[model samples]
Target: MTVRSAWLLPGGTDSPGQTREDTRLAPVGTMLPDGELGTRPGVIPGGDPFAATGAGAMSLQVATGRAQVQGTAAQGAYPVCLDAPEVVTFADGDAQFDRIDTVCLHVYDALFDTAGQNLAAVEVIVGSATDTPTAPTLDPACLPLWDVRVPAGASAGVGGIDWTSALTDRRRYTAAVGGIVPRGALSDVGAYDGQYADVEGLLYRWSTADDEWQLYRAPELPVETITDGADTATGWTLNSFDARRHGRVVQILGYWVRSGETLTTNPNIADTLIATLPTGWRPVVLVEAIASNGYGFGAVAIGTDGKLTVRSWAGGEKANALEKDTNVRVAATFVQ
Candidate 1:
């Protein structure tokens, strides 16, 4: 029986026999979806796999890790692993120039390697030396682990590489085939833009332009209530005052009673201050909403300065009048 057929059926009296190549193909088949044979390649996220660290002046160490690679032309999927930390060193820096070197995990198969050894190894691609250098090109069978920046005149002893600021992590992770990527597996790689992630039961999309994860739905801020007397208007006791935000919308609800000084019907009350909203609850433009006094209906305006002002009154009530010991209800919704 053929190698593919050998693994396709259950063993039955010499009818089929599985080979090593068939066993290797099992993971690849399981990881790729139908009609998408060899498209995705990435590290399996867990235990800080393949994390890079500074070993010395010009050397960096890679921790034990596991990853998968899809060969070109969708030929096969190969699983790679590093059982122990491996240190990779670099040449001394150029006299007057800096360069970026890429550390990668390269997978070699008998089909592609002249030596015919199917294995994975750590390798570095040296970059060009210049004032402004970039990472080197990577082979299809390789996964970049990190980018190390070697400044000019850097050496092993006195003037050496600064471990803290020299390493730029470039590792990208992938999830199982036909699954939504979790928050822990999210990558900053721009190539994965438009990918979706499940973060704490909320869906987020990767935005390449912004280089960040954006919420798929509008964010709802927590409702904040104002109960302190310091935030209440003078002579006005708050019954209920609160503010909440959802996306670009700001809403405020307040019910207050005038307990002390009351305005007379002589002066204008078009801009009389009722209460002040907190900073984040303020609106860009004036927001006018219908308010209810104990006697009749009136209008209140929320301004950019966060002040809630009485605008007008109706139903035989004078516009310039505010009754004493009466309750006022104001609610306004506006875009920030």
Candidate 2:
């Protein structure tokens, strides 16, 4: 019973954005119950689905088919999970078939916001590795914006930019020459949902006829900009879009806040109305990590069970009341 697609439902059928009768056959090794789900559970790879080699563990999750990863601090022998390029064998025979191919890998993380009801921001790490991660290839799906003459020996992360820095220097970052730049002290505004969520923005996706990764602005965010600020960006270590933007820093900003809080356009977690939430309800928020200094996406929270939630709009916008008990943490990353 090999699967063609895989999904990660954080909550059961009762969860928001998920229908009561939501049961789809995923690729082989699709419905694996926790434990371990990496290509080599022990050997860490350089690319995505990399060897879960991090000593410090964080609870990570992504919606089925979605590329976003959510996490919380975990105290133990950390067992990291990589953005697996594809799934091979289930290892366990009880799962029926052996190998399965995955079109997308969506994970979910709830530990970051225990309060569930009031999570201000979160850090979402997305991988740009290709469908085959074993022997990695450079897939510039959402290249980060960076300058040329990049630091000697400096390599690129997902989408083709280098972000391996304690403090990203914004000096190297240059915008499209003229436009309204974003606010904040070193914010990394992304377009088409990058590997990391550090600024308030949207990541609409598109593909060229040739299958090249062509990104569109999130429907909610209609306006964007990237003035001549690469030098300021380089100072922040802003580099990743080179593969796509070719040194032009494109910024995603101005998302339409519906009902003063929730988003106006994003896929529901579930296909049916049963799992659908009201028009004005946003499960998570894209915020900056003020506590951690620098600019990283902040997160919002929805409790495990028996709770209520709502998103707090920027400029101190109030949110609508969410029904309790059926707390469904609905982010716009659901791919089904």
Over all chains combined, what TM-score does candidate 1 have?
0.50
The residue-level lDDT of candidate 1 at 73 comes to 60
Model 1 bad stretches (over 4 Å): 1-29, 32-35, 182-195, 198-202, 205-215, 218-336
Q: Write the per-residue lDDT of candidate 1 for residues 1-336, one digit (tens) a residue.
A: 000111111121222222223122224334422133464566777779888888888888888776776667645556665665777777778799998988886665556656345545577778888988999887667777788898988899755788899899877666666555554343444234666766667877767788887878765665544443326667687888766677668667788887866655444444567788877768999889778876676788888888777767653254545776778888788998
Whole-model lDDT values for every prediction = 0.66, 0.21
The 10-residue segment with the lowest total lDDT in model 1: 1-10
Error of 1 at 279 (Å): 41
Find the 10 residues in a row with the least total lDDT in model 2: 288-297
Model 1 has an lDDT value of 0.66
- lDDT of prediction 2: 0.21
Off by over 4 Å in 2: 1-107, 114-336
Question: After TM-score superposition, what is the CA distance of residue 330 in candidate 1 from its true location, in Å?
Answer: 18
